[model samples]
Target: MSDEARVVRIVPNGPVMVQGPVRIEMPDGTVVESDRFMCAICTCRRSKIYPLCDTSHRRRQRAKDDESSTTVTVQAPAEA
Candidate 1:
């Protein structure tokens, strides 16, 4: 380990950023490494690339609000 400090930042509703180069050991006994200046680790588990952020956690646009509007009707049971 180097004397330099490693910084980790947790982004709200997003991935966790880490200062690389880093070596990560997966649950399957496999090790993954990255030598990039920074690394984005997925927290939402929605990334197509596990342990990496592909911006898959971003909110997607749903059908137009007006077109996708839903109306619910509740009916009372008949009196005994």
Candidate 2:
């Protein structure tokens, strides 16, 4: 493999897979580095650890439904 080459793969409704070691520059000029061979960058913003994927992109389950409806359902779009 070339020294300058890295592979980035995008998962279906998930994070962007990036080959590391990667240095991420935050908006405030903070630098975050990862020495792992591969890293997952979060796209969903729900992660407590921002800029890193913690599998927070998955769909949420509603805890309760209205009294009028006994069953509640959710439909997510198919991956493109």
Identify the candidate with maximal lDDT.
1
In angstroms, give how far residue 8 of model 2 lies from its true place.
0.6
| lDDT (Cα, tens digit) per residue for candidate 2, span 1-80 | 68886789999888899987777777665566676688778888886456776566768633334222212122343345
- The residue-by-residue lDDT of candidate 1 on 1-80, one tens digit each, is 68987899999999899987667777665566666687778899987566776677888733455322222122343346
Model 1 lDDT vs. the true structure? Answer: 0.68
Once model 2 is optimally superposed onto the true structure by TM-score, how far is the C-alpha of residue 61 displaced, in angstroms? 12
TM-score to native of every candidate shown: 0.68, 0.65
Stretches of candidate 1 exceeding 4 Å from the true structure: 60-80
CA shift at 57, candidate 1, in angstroms?
0.4
Which clashing pairs does model 1 show?
A: none
lDDT by candidate, in order shown: 0.68, 0.65
